[model samples]
Target chain A: MALDQSVSRRRLLQLIGGASVAATAVGTLAACGGGGSGSSSSGGTLKVIGVGDQEAGLRKVLDAYKSSHSGFDFNLSFAPADQVQTALRTQLGGGNAPDVHVVYPGNGSAMSMAQLAKAGLLADLSSQSWTQKIPDGFKGAFQSDGKTYIFSPGSSMLGAIYNKKAFATAGVEPPTTWSELLSVCEKLKAKGIVPIALGAQTPWITQLIPYALVPGTVYAKTPDFDDKMLAGQASFAESGWVDAMNKYLELQKKGFFNDNPNGTTYEQATSMVATGKAAMAVQVSAVLSAFRAASQTPDDLSMFPFPATDVAADNWIPAGVVVGIAVSAKSKKSDQAKSFLDYCGQQENLNTWAEAVSCVPLYGDAKVDPALTLFLPALKANKAVPFMDQRWPNAEVQPTHFAVVQELLGGKTTVDAALKKMDEAYRKKA
Target chain B: MPAVLVYAVVVLYPSIAGAGSAFTDWSGIGNAKTFVGIDNFKQLAHDSQALGALRNTLLLTVAIVVVQNGIGLLLALGVHTGIKSRMALRLVFFAPVVVSPVIVSFLWKFVYNPAPDAGLNAALGAVGLGALRQDWLGNPSLALWSVAFTVIWQCAGYSMVIFLAGLEGVPAELHESAMVDGAGTVARFRHITWPLLAPAVTINVMLSTVGGLTLFTQIIAMTNGGPGYATDTLSTVLYKQAFVFGKFGYSTAVALVLAIFVAAVSFLQIGYLRSRETAA
Candidate 1:
């Protein structure tokens, strides 16, 4: 009993000693983590966070800003596209948001404008001199309660990017009607070429074809379709979404896509079209450079609107701002970040930024890239509509669309079944 | 006192706060939350995707635990015998565990590609088993199993080292005596070696159960719980709901369910294994 009591006493002392050490260590760490707030360095350094190719483009813009304003300095960080939203959201929630960040223009995407504005995480940019320069089409995208919060440099069009040389080899013209598109596919198939390169392995790629087609199928006649959806008067299943989805499925039925599109990655799909193994791929303008970079001859590639209807006159292109820059409401460097935004708003600066990302300049007077000249006719004729998802109320709906499209491609679900799933997600009270 | 303070500040506080938030409608942004009073849990009960994810989680856990342990024991047994190449072979088997799970998943993704000329398919074709070639990760039916295979491949070596330690602990004299008494290799292994491995088996099963239940990186890297939620484990579902959808409250509720499940299942397994260890 005496021995056991001594052992117990020793163990208790050891535990107490260990605990005190842990406490001291934790306290030291806490002290180190909580440093001085002396200088307000936030005002001196403009921190910007972006993702994907946007990083390289933004870095160039920052360099230009530095040279022009010799005393200005900035910090920039980049993450993978998939991680950017999560990283930014966590930072904002922790009250350490970057001074400037890349946010999607509308509510449908991750890091959407509306949600951030609702959270009061975004600074009101309505008073900024550049706010007035925003086009009518884009003004509604970044506004909440009639107050602007985001400034986008440009917009991107989603369409069928084809190898011009491959088309010439197959003797098939870019189709203006749905049936004509099928006939072109048949011709391309006979010439031993994949008609369309679909990278369904990347879920976002699954959404692009449907988005590219929806303009002509759903919104050409019903420009108020998204409005009806917001008012709870319409659902995806009851609207022209079924038509767009059916057109998407028809390509699968004809065996026009590459074998095992669900297995093909985005890189593979881009390379397939770029190398002329496939005739075309329905993708966004943002990836045009990626495709070009993979091509032996970048000049051989061009884009055309993906037609969803038989009427050539009714065809429309899907277009939307790819990403917008926003100032964090918590930033002490709001003025400095706004200065960067101000610099971004200049016509020359906007043109440089837009061209780097292969985007259509938001300003009408800005010089357009020669490669984007193909989209000019549609834009000038008012046949290009903003991406349908841009008008959606929440982020969840876009991913739901992606999964449904993947299911449709894989022959796992019907158009109606898939559309019903989308409608269910749309009606989810976010 | 310091330990308690640290625990209270870091682990206990966050856990209690997280549990509290599970009952609210916090969207993980700004301080807007309303107490929904178990509504999130009720939604989880009705959420087909969440239920499906739970089912996948259970299935994946079982598959990984059984397959990983079986392969590990085999490798351990092989290395235990006096083979000239045992050391090198043991090193080879254990190598994969040191590689990151993300890289492992990515490497396996290429190997399991469904294309005719892809790694596994080409190997099958070369072996005249072309009919067995499959869309390993793309097919809904095969995707869960495919990801489970990757998980098993990465960790089987870890399990082997544990079983190896247990095997080393078994008395060589006992095996020699049993052989002298006319015991065959099978009989000796069944009666002596198997019973002696109880502690190692217990440790392995518990570790595997916990790891399998909380699997996220492999699923995310390979499938992203995709091909239309065919492989959505609870962790992936929680991540999507919280991070992707911004339904942090609902996601936390799902996370709470997952936590309860992991704890209950792990407790039951450990109890059963411990009882077996005592009996043996």
Candidate 2:
């Protein structure tokens, strides 16, 4: 007991000492740094750690904000995409999480904003007006109960991004509907070009095909899909999710995708479509910048939301996803953080974000880039959904989805078998 | 014992913590941790995805151990012929072991690409063997073999080195006496050469078995265990659960099973090898 007491006492002292040192370092950084947390009384820095793309945009936005308000400085640090989550967990575990960060809650991803909130790591921004202003449809995807954990600047529309030039040269138009998309794929293939660039080797890339179709399946075939599945009132078989899997299988059968599509990577597909070797690919709007960066000109590529079907009820299904931002609960500068979130809600910053990233702003009158016009119809229709894996019950669903896609492509498991495996996987605790 | 204790804290504790988590319903993180005993493991019993991973892991461990050790022992014997070119050949054979798995994965990924433009497919076509070309990493029938080949390639040399070290330690007088006793090469190898290389066999078998079973980085970088779970292993399953799907408890359970598996196999190998040494 004495040894235990002494050991714990030493640990407590060490923890307290560490905390004091951190507080002092933050103090020193705040004193010298000019990043403003909007409502800062002593003028402190809002340390934001995220991917290079978001960090860069945040820095640009901060630069503009700094032009108007002289006190705020952003002590910006970034990790490449792969390292972000691990870095965040390490920092947060050390009681020094970034004041601002991005959260992606797909399968296997950590630092999910909701998971953070569930852990009491997120600031309670229930009072934030912008959180309330989020569209009702989007609120469920972002907030749990009545509390907001993250603030996403813009939402993404998932679909095929193709080279307009290549399509025109091939004497083909981009697919407007699912059948038409397949038909367009056939035509592209006839021209001795690879049709769809399916990056199946990257499990997540395989996910986009089904993710783009989830809304249609739910909204069209079974309106009660989400509720029924959650309530145990439905299974994957009943929901036409199996039908979606069959369609994926048919694509493999038709040879509409690249040969050994499972061998291609997300980046390789982006390169293929950008270079006009492949006609189309199903990917996220976030990939637009990457596609653009890979392309000769940003205008060379364009997006189209997943093709509409005959079901009228499917009109509400948007092929887009939501990414929100939330403040950390343990932050000392909660008031300042809330004010900054409010600032993000302002039209100026929202517009700036839309312009910089070619993103669809969730609120305010931000203009969509001309290139993203193909997806405007769906976005305006209010049919958007968050990434499907983010909404799944367990982590297994994400990889299960990957496995199913691979099987569907591989000719090993039938659609029914694969979907059965998926539905069963969802019940797993892990 | 203290050093081992430190290792237990650093390593074993996390595993035990994972096992504890498997009993609870911890969704990655949070204070709302719920206790639901045996639920995660129960879930695994019904999980075909986890079952697929288990199958793949077992298949891979078996194949790589048998194939890698077979090749390694063959090469060790083949090259231990006391030739001047042996040094150069050793460098060539062991080269893949030093290259990072990530770089090798990229190289093999290209080789596995089934497209007409792919190097392997193009070469097949050039050789009039187009029909023989397969989507080595994309076809469900082939993905497992594709990854296993890479594992064997990378690890066979390591096994060879272990066997080589063991082979070099064998007394030349024993082999010469066997030869003088009218023993042929095959007879000498069967009794003396094989029996003495037990330590190397144990080490090589254990190392390759673990390497094949755990199976990360290369499989992930090369194939991400796709073509419909054809290449999935326990580590990949554990990863998909904990990190991807936010099922920390269940994923940790998978990890615990893997740990126990590695331990059991190691124990068996060591015990078998020690007995063999005593028998000799």
Candidate 3:
């Protein structure tokens, strides 16, 4: 290395700065001309991405599609739910989005149908044969500007999953009222059993108790709570959410939860209920199989609608699409992708997909799984509401909700103070 | 021209593009971004979670720098003595450094399990010290410290290896003469060895400080910035803001602030330490 004594530090900085400026200019220009999906012009490999078990199920669907559709091949990929959103967004930004990608049914998600459709990243699927099969309520989740942009095969309900054996052992039935729930906790505690296996260490798990309680307390009285929230007429702090938060805190004060819930993971919480150490946990219906797998008698695990109000009829279960799929706007084989989605929408294919993943079928005529029969009464009465977070304005609110609830549970903040913080996050102008 | 183009494309372009977002209301989605002019930074100042993240980042960095370097120096000293098993001990201590931070965090997460009879609590309870067991990663006050301990645990051996290299650079004659002069062990280390180890100290401090400041994977894996915003650092908050919240402009402002802090701190620390380096 030769010494460049003539190059002063100031001059060196200038040179570096100039080089960076020139590089940025070229980089931006190059990014503008970034490659589109090369196979977009005609039949080729249709890249499909899904998260977790959705990917595995989609793989089976794709394998079927490949046999029936001769012109196009399919590439399948999977990521965890959060990472799937990240991967889709990154690819969408780079203009090489997957030909078919898993999307959330509605807004408040990163790859929400509303946002993707707004960005013109999803191909219109309004003309697909499957569009007629979608019921009116689900039509809004997959459509924007009166054009369908995504297809959801099924939905999942969020409720309390309990060990039937433990409940039987304690001589208590599933509680249908808030007071009954408290009494059941007392009975379980008296019997030396943990009433609920809470895993607040996981922020998602921390939000579950509040979510499960919010519908009956808030939505039952005000059915349009989330709509009001989106319209800025209601705030999380003021919309009976405080009552819901109070009920969650009440559970803690009454010592109904497991020891060191904040330290326990979602996996450990599942194990707790699976092994009959704890009686129950507030969880999504999707994880019922995981609980069953962890126990010798998988049949001992069953679910019930978690009641949040004293009036039994006021209780509502939260349910929504687990994941939906969208065709990339820039895809070359978009027709093939739509063809595959159409095949998925057929009653037989829908049943296969739903049964494979243990999700509730979306179509009216589709077969409902026996495992999910517990929620049919609530569903039949039309008492099930969409998840509160599904209609939230943006992703920031749920996380803030998670953190504040965790803090409340950890004794770091009061319910009012935590909800106040959530209000601040929710009110952040987009 | 090619060199300038490469630098512009790879380095200058992204920084400029990223900095541009710090001033606008971009959401990393559509191309439309309205210039907000310092609103993001303004929000950060009042944003309690952002402030908490900044405070936690500083605390984590300070804790990591002091503790990691101290333990590394101690380990180096221990292994440098005429112990026959020094090589094996060195390998054992350095093993964690080779493992990815994500894996290390996962492993330590199991170790810090909050269950009454699982992991750390189980061990604590087994020794008839059950009362000492607490939720390690779930309590707000303890989560930050617990994560910091895990970071230090993973990186201390890295610092030790650097110190050991610096120790080898010290000639035996200097220590022999100092011992011959009847100087105490502490005196010899303080007067002779400590001053000479300045280069290693600077390296270890710089590496640990940078690592601690940019800490993300471990926190995300171990606690995800919970049991309630207690363990969030700047990087994790930035990820959440940009990716989850879709606040690209605001997150860029956060990134810009973090970049400035890290650069200024590293520059100052390295400068001060370099000036302290003794000429052999």
Error of 2 at A297 (Å): 3.2
lDDT tens string, model 2, B163-269? 99999988999999999999999999988988899888877877887787788888777766677778888888887666555567777778877888889988887
Lowest summed lDDT window (length 10), candidate 1 chain B: B134-143
Judged by DockQ cut-offs, the docking class of candidate 3 is medium
> Which 10-residue window in model 3 chain A sums to the lowest lDDT?
A23-32
lDDT score, residue A424, model 2? 82
lDDT of candidate 1 at residue A380, scale 0 to 100: 53
Candidate achieving the largest TM-score: 1
- What local lDDT does model 1 show for residue B10? 96
Worst 10 residues of 2 chain A by lDDT: A23-32
Backbone clashes in model 3, listed as residue pairs: A23-B8, A23-B9, A24-B8, A24-B13, A40-A332
- Residue-wise C-alpha lDDT for candidate 1, range A1-430, written one tens digit per residue: 2332122212322322221221111111101111122122223668899876575457778889887775678888887666765778889888999989988776776588888888998877766555665554555565666677787777777888899988998898888889999999999999999999987978778888888787787777776677778888888898788888888888888899987777778888999999999999998777787788899999998887888889987787777776778889888887778778777877788777777777776664544445555565566566667677776777789888877777777678899999999998888877
Computed on C-alpha atoms, the DockQ of candidate 1 is 0.46
lDDT tens string, model 3, A1-430? 1232122323322322221221111111101112232222346888888876475457777787678667768788787665665657878877888888988876776678877777778887766666665554555566666677777766777888998888888899988899999998898888888999998876678888777888788877887776676678888778778999999989889999997888888789988899988999998776676787789888898888788999988887777666778888887777667777778877777767766666676664445445566666566566667666666666677778888888888899988888988888777664
**Could you tell me the TM-score of chain A in candidate 2?**
0.81
Query: What's the best-to-worst order under lDDT?
Result: 1, 3, 2
